[model samples]
Target: MDSINVSELVERLGSDEDAVRKMAVFKLQGCVLDPSFADVFILEDGLTKLRHLTLHATGNTLAYSLTSFSRLLEVDKGWEYVNQDLVERVVELVVTHPLVNILRGAMSILVFIVSHPYTASNRISQPDSFGFRALQPAMTVYPQFLEMLVSRLSSADHALCANALLLINSLMREAITNDSEADWPKFIKQLQDLDVIKAVYTLMQSTALQDLSHPLIEFQALTKVLLRKWRDVPVDLNKSDHRRALKSIHLASNPERVTTPVDDGEEGSKKRHNPEKWRRLGFESETPAWEFEEVGYLGMMDLTEYVRQQEDGFPKLLLEQSTKLSEQRCPIARASLAVTSILCEHFEIEKADVDDAKIQLSFESRTNFDKVFKPLILQWSLLHTAGLQAFFRLWQTTGAETEDFMKIADLVRILLEAVVGGATRVSDVHEVETEIQQFELARLRHLQMELLELTYEDHWGHHLGQMRDELDHEALQFVKEQRIRCLLAGAWFSNGHGHKSDNVAVAKQDLNPSNPTSQRYAKLAHNRRFLHYADFDVRDDEEPDLEGLVEKIDLTTVSSVVLAPSEPSSSTTTLKATHKFISTRKVTIYGYLLANSRPASPKIHPRMGSTATKTPRKEVTLLTLHPQTQSLAAEWLDGLLMLLNYKPITDETKRLIAMVQDYGLKIRLLNVRFDDMALAGDSPEIPSREGLDEDYYYDILGN
Candidate 1:
């Protein structure tokens, strides 16, 4: 290399042709690694000017030079000149740099600056929490820059446009494949822009580049990068809306991933974001991975994210209130619908496994499982106010929407439709006698289908006790029907009505025209087989009137609904599941409340097993009635153990033996106080009634 051409190279390093300047600056730096320049370049101002030239240089010209300069500055004692002002300017330009490639390599400088002990210490001392942020500028500008990059993709300059899009797209794909979201909104917005859509669509139209045939790169960026970031935020650090409003971006992004499943590690990483990436890396699997990706999956992430945030806020009472309002049971319903919606999206993914019933968790029972929404509810409902609502929703959907229940409803609908189709195909057997069974099948099937629809819709809107008021909301109709059905079921099903003699006549009267589902079952009104549906207080009547649904449910089943505690609804029933009833064996123990449990239809009969019989599920409790504060010592463990058949042995007890292993709950109880009621009553203090055992916490919940 030629020496002493510093003057010429500095001039050229600022040239418009980035490649020429990049080569010149890099070449000059290698030659001048010599320490002799220290004396000749002694003036601090001269070094400052050089530093400015290196830092402010654009594109390759600047990036190539800055990489060496960053090294040189550290190698020299040049950091002595660093101050708050200089550091800020250096960080600002590195962050706001317009060129994508220039910005990419330039971030290391900010990373370098903030990584210094003094710098890190200085940042933490300040209140804004920006010391760490200065190092990760990608978090702030990434979303914005992604927006710009995406817009450029639709440009008319084919070569530049295609090259730029290809490079940016690849970088984004690599990031997503790594399951990283260095900057989510910026990154997603770019891919979602029209340029990406048009480029993929236009490429598909022509058989130009065989490489352009796949759109996995774009989709991976959308789901793994964008949507995932939006949903899978750090719970403690999150600042997103509970409903996932950012998903409007998906409208511009490919939506196939909503139904696909993800693979583990690198085999999955290269799948969608870039097929060539997979090919280049020598990872072998089918190109363009689409499994574990889907809208339903995204929905799960969104709701789960809210739960995670709620989880983070559990310690702060005021914050817990906000989280409860923000997440709580609504997400449970949302996730329930979302998983069910996934079933509708792809028929083949789930081959209908036998254990689906076993694994199929109620919104109440599923706690801490990754895809579960229940843990989040438990986290929120632990609050004094939200507990009851959590319990109510849990029970409301239990009998009406157990996985077994939905499965049964599905079977009925399918058989009914099959019968209807068969009746349509036959012309000779059109007589009323021949069609009676088919019609009956269709009617019963329709009832089941409607019930499924009811359970699928969420009754709670944005707040507890606040019913969704929009008349046009189809979801509201589902809630209203449930309310009416429960109301009518309350009054007529109980023996208090005293007309328990002719069951057929009762069924027919309940199925009369006034009932919601009566059209097909009207004949039952005369036979006393009418089913009491619910009770409702019509404004015109001074008293709540008794009404019934079109079908006759078992009276024993209706009695199980604990409608308003001792006040049984007309729909009361005692019939259990098809299996034998898990007789009234109750115990008190501790576990999280599932959610707001509402009264549900009575249990179904149990299935006859070959050897080991299936355990019957309890009628999930409707709305957890929290024990009084004064009763924590005497009642807390006893009441909870009653439900789970569990008792606290000692802190040394293992989880398998201990029915409840919730850490957060144990913390809450420590702070909770029950007043000394005996002192107020002048009966003297009782040692058995107060104070928690310190050993229990240190062994179980304490660090």
Candidate 2:
């Protein structure tokens, strides 16, 4: 096409006719391939028309326009024809365009325009060459563009999300170049703040998006850049610091800093600025492998520190999602494992860095167990098998010597203490009944075998045996010193609130918009449910303080633990409670605290022997649903019977027992059994069964 035809085509691209505009874009695509057409395209203001066509055109027309634009920029000396206005328009389309394909096209054009060689000759007259000048417009609008692109990462449309990722990667590549160098610290910090890297990683791992074809290479490129920066650049250690200031500290910034630069064929091109030549010479590829191949002792410590940093700043949403996705064996969970494994490898490298003789075995033992391994193991235990595999792989690779065994021993001690608490149990017979309980037991057993193997008959004199013996002794002593403890909660009923103690304040209920009158009735009812982690301690004489969910009940309380079925409500209930059980299965504990007594006689209920005598005792009845199952309620009943010294003698005691029996409660005597000597009583005070050879069992009922 001549200059006259270029001008006509540019005019026709802006024509009202869609077909005319599409034809104009199609012709321009061919014209842009010729070296002589650059002047005609520039003089006729073709870029402005092309940008308009890309934004306004639809379907094939838009695709044609984008192709034409990219070809124009890719041609020799083609970038010099571009200007700031045209760049801005393309970026605007990239950010706001509804179609994923169009967005990808616009992004492609933008990346090409920014990175393409601009001048006719490759030689640069000055530091601010054509490539640098062309990129200045992009840098000016980058923050806004980046914000928009990052927001698309969470789009339900995987294709849109994938394109958004590619756009961001391209933008990052352009920004971080030597020509228009981004502030690496600031740029990376912003990406982290937006959770861009994490979001990309999650997208890569999402099972929901697994079937959809995505730009994995682009995603990898973006994450690699981010990780490279995370390792290379200094970032703020304290995430809570809003400023996100980079610290002066640096660690292994460049392992191959002395690698000489190679001369590229581009005569006047700076080798340092030419990323392609650097990639070709293998500096970028080779350096990471060398630096990360083996971590020294300090490097291991550094890895530990990185783990700490990640754990502390891990997002709450991700934590919640981890539990849900862990069992799914999804990409996100695998990604977490991959990350953990890499860090573990770093630990191995670091451990190798320290000579075995010079290594402070005691310090390594303590730090590995307490600071590194134990904390991770405990926190990730909920991850089940995947979590176990990660830590186990680390353990197997890093150390298996005596110190490592000691660390394992230390880990076992912690798990034992946490799971058993103060239970006097050293039995091999585990009550691995429920799935959760079974998982806990299995983990304990795994740890036990692992620790025991180091101390068996062959290595009797090893420190492992001594540690095992100490552990066994500690276990027995702990069990004897500790009282029985269990979690419980308060369940609300039709007539009254579940919480019997006035000390327990009722939580206010939320107002219902549809039925405003229900709010007033809720206040009048005064019954509030308290459901939180509650503990019942048998040793304390003080009444259980109902603070939030947990409570500690006194064993000295004069009362009985009764299981009662919930009474059906006579009045209409709110929508919130409609789906809930109409009649809840519940347990009610009746007691009287002497501490709440007054000299004056309280008004007794007419049904109770109309005695208005002068001992004002506060009668308390705490009610709650059976935690886990009703069998637990029965266990509570039995435990309370043992602690409160229950026996029916007086009519009142018999009546209470009869009342408990009336409510389907199993009334069993607290019977303690022993191998050395059997207590001669229908009921024994301390209901624990122990023998010199057998494991301990707490028998609540006699044979």
Best by lDDT: 2
Which lDDT values do the candidates have, in the order given?
A: 0.34, 0.42
TM for every model, in the order presented, reads 0.24, 0.34
- For model 2, how does the per-residue alpha-carbon lDDT over 405-459 read when each residue is reduced to its tens digit? 3343344343434343322122111321122233353465455544445333233
Model 2 stretches with alpha carbons more than 4 Å out: 1-11, 14-19, 26-64, 71-77, 96-102, 114-142, 156-159, 174-182, 206-214, 225-703
Q: Which stretches of candidate 1 lie over 4 Å from their true place?
A: 1-24, 28-50, 55-63, 70-132, 135-703
